[model samples]
Target: MTKTPPGLPLRDYAALGDGRTVALVAPNGRVDWLPLPNLDSVPVFARILDEETGGSVELVPREAYESSRRYVEKTNVLETTFTTASGVARVTDAMVTGVAGRLPWAEFARRVDGLEGSVEFTWRISPGTMLGTRSPWLDRVGEHTIIRCGQLSMAVVGSDHGPASSDPTSADPAELHGHFATTAGSRHLLVLTATEGEPLRVPDPAKVDEGIDRTIDSWLTWSDEFSYEGPWSEQVQRSALALKLLIHSPTGAIAAAATTSLPENPAGGKNWDYRFAWIRDLAYTAHSLTWFGLREETHAAISWLLRTIREQGPDVLVMYSLGGSTCAGVVEYDVPGWRGIGPVVTGNPAQGQLQLGIYGDLIAISRTYVDDGNLLDVETARLLAKVADKVCDEWRSRDAGMWELEDEQHYTSSKMGCWQALTDAIALADGAHINGDVARWRAERDRIHDWTDEHCWSEDLASYVMHPGSDRLDASVLLHAPSGFDRGERMSSTIDALTRELGAGHLLYRYSGVADEEHTFVACAFWRVSALACVGRHDEAVAAMGALVTQTNDVGLLAETVAAGDGAFWGNLPQGLSHLALINAALMIKDLAPKEAHDDQ
Candidate 1:
């Protein structure tokens, strides 16, 4: 098989989401990656993976043009401006939201507002299913153009003219190409509505236009509730907006990231689907949202997570499907991966991995919930107690660390996480939030802490090693300083050690061994920032944060990883964990910085 040429840099794409699904719009006006109906659904446009056979929705200029884009203030609505010698045009993109909740049908609206001299705008809709397993066909329903593949159907409406070209002679007959010329003061609108199992609803043009207004209004209203007024407030709000996009409004589950199978390592084989909600990521998201005074999203996310745990009977998997069901098994695609990184796979096998850090995550979220004055329902309380018991029973056993390493070890970070979980559990039990063996939890928590201090710390290295018997450094440990596991000189020294060993300027790899293989994990860098502030390295923390925030894409979205050498983005788009980390780190600096720092700003 021949490799497809690389697409645009990962930073060149901005995301648009309406609580259910996301579309990655390229600077060149192509909707290259969109999973219809839901974030985890089979892609209807997968050109980001296989640019050759995979399809896209293009609304690009016919001539070369300089482009720039940004999200409308406090919203996910994306506006891209193309400037050419002859003319300038702006395309406003949004996934039209409903008045009450998620719209019954998925509607992606793109409005073109001509800003200057005449410019020819060309567009095409070519649909493809997951891994190209299903073929899409075009059918004209009255004046509406419908594209159907298996159970999914999409209707293209709103443009005044019909498709300029259709491959009626081809077997699949999916491509619908068209073009229109617009001068200054002229405007055109295109809306694509996707539905599954139900009959296609070709939305009226005027209704779609109104829906766009409602979507923008809804986002603005949500933004109005933010109470953050600290350093980097704009970036914090933008990150919060990005995180809001990942929230599945129907179920309140927050996906780890919006796209699937974006490579972490430039050489490939490290790609995994991040569209499902990880318990750890959800807990972090809730914690960050709570700090921002965004109680609704935090409450909704925790409620959904607890409900899922209760239904699953407390033997919590690492992650769950957005609908709170068991995730399907991993399946490899026959297509080339992003940028010819081979073996594009869907579904994550890490769903069942015993990542012991989740115990700490759940307990941290529970602590935040109760501290915020929200009482836990009986079922959730019981679930928390049961999970705490499991942590107590399993803390001594070797398990996967937070990095989800394949080799199970007595990871020091995992032990610290369990220590954190049991400590919080005892606190909750004492507070009457749940009934548990407080005495036993206290004993185990102390023992875990003592064991970590004795074994994890390396006097030789002057830092905590990855595990008891290993010399490797893992960035996961940096999280503990802010988690309250260790905030003393030891952690301070560990921060220095981590920066000396694993830090690539302000970026960091997950562990020592993978530095040559994968991009630096963006979340870890932010964790370091938080760790620095925790240890009272205020100047260093502020400087580090300044450098890290500069890594965000043009529209303020961060991917999962970034190239250590050049700071280019890799991995999943609009990573929730990365954004959560950024928000938390900014808040940490704000709280820890001396009064002079704030006065200086």
Candidate 2:
């Protein structure tokens, strides 16, 4: 066995996928984390989540070699090149695609082609079913192969999960017969489709080929909708693709990330599972999706979210599983932590927190929907009314803020949310919505705004404090600009205070240095960027935005936070909130860019 680098090394994984599922490809050519059928489902290949029992599918060059990898231009197709003493070999990985309504199927595909000289490689495939609970029983069936285990039966061809060896000829199975040479130019393919206990259908190779072509075409076609013309176009585009990969296609809900329990800090107890969808996250996602002209995704996320909130009643939970199921109870998994981040946990404790700001996020989304010509039904209106009433009754009550901290307090941002929810609700009633207490809402809205100004603002700190009677400054309040709460002199002052107190190098901490050594909140920085753009600080905002993009991994993937000292990625990776904030900040800055610049070129 090759000795892994110390500190539970991840082997430098990158993701590739169709819209449905993602595969995390490791540096040594092993696919470590893959959740089939859906993003939130139990992993079918989960070595990253559990290094011992969790299985993986690997492709390794037969000789000693160096390797480098990148995603293909403007697409999710991953290309990894392995260079041996003789020459280089490139392996491309992608998941096969299907139409929106196509059910009961999905694909994982790989193509290996030589670049220069004869290079040999080996392949090892071991699939862990349902979060490593079972291993598939593979049996050869003519040209095709079958993996039967429990409720899932899959037919695969072109590759087999055999024994592990760096040599190509170590263990030969019928399904494992792809050869690589300098001039041979061999083509090999492996696809796994979920049959879901139904009779398995053996399709022809030509159909599979067509599916691959159509999948590539769909991604290329969908990517054209992005209208960003920015300095880091490639990084922005890859961020968009990673966001798409994290989205659950069946319901159009974007997951927070592909894998969970990936740790906020390697040794810190900040590990969180982000596969669930939060109301705040969904709203941010919808805002970005709409700006990108993906109305379908926007509408789907909004509709699903609204229906889910309706089912869960007018009160919104902090988050929900991808299927809108509220069964996420945080449990520590019986496995080693990622990169030695102990206590790999599932479920989020924040799900049960009394986050009063969720109502504001919901109302913000609904207001945006109305702005986009989508009419609000009576049910949504009634739900908004209940939320507004709750805000009116409890704006001053102690509860967790947007950060989901354990210590409930009269969070200033939560107070701002009260103002936002009522403000948007009143706007909704004035439009085509049903009857609501517009006068009462307005009265309460103004009251909450005044209360925030009186109690939340601190003269000594020269910014809005984290909570009432506290001098601690929170970076979250920087969202006041996007929330339309404060602008002009007050906004400028708050921005200056935040820059002075919370800023470290280029990264912004969630609060002052006193807040438990928190990781530099990546999304909060983006929020600062958006707020700066809103306040007409275009040059600084663009520079900050550019710096934020630089913090991304080589593939333009971001974690929930980036360590300030060395700028290493930390926290949950490929974070949806970070991407969502990026999309909004990009648009906000674009809108603020001088029109003369548009006319100049």
* Residue 570, candidate 1: C-alpha displacement in angstroms: 1.0
Clashing pairs in 1: none
TM-score of each: 0.97, 0.91
Candidate 2 residue-wise lDDT, 292-350, digit = tens = 77788888899888888889764688887788778457777666656555566678889
Task: Write down the lDDT of every candidate, Cα atoms only.
Answer: 0.87, 0.74
Output the number of the TM-score-best candidate. Answer: 1
TM-score of 2: 0.91
Residue-level lDDT of model 1, residues 1-601, one tens digit each, is: 9964678789888889988999999989999898888888888788999877778888988888999888899999999999988899889999998889579889999888889997888888888766778878877777666788778898777655335578788644788888887789987888888998887777888888888889999989999998899889999999999999899988999999998888887778889999898989999989888877888889889999888877875488899999999889999989987888867888998978898888888988998899988898888888888888888889988998887888999998899889889988988998999998888888888988998999899999899999987888888998899888998999999988888889889988888888888888999999999999998899999999999999998889999999877778899888999998999999999988888997887
lDDT of 1: 0.87
* Candidate 1 residue spans exceeding 4 A from truth: 1-4, 161-164, 170-172
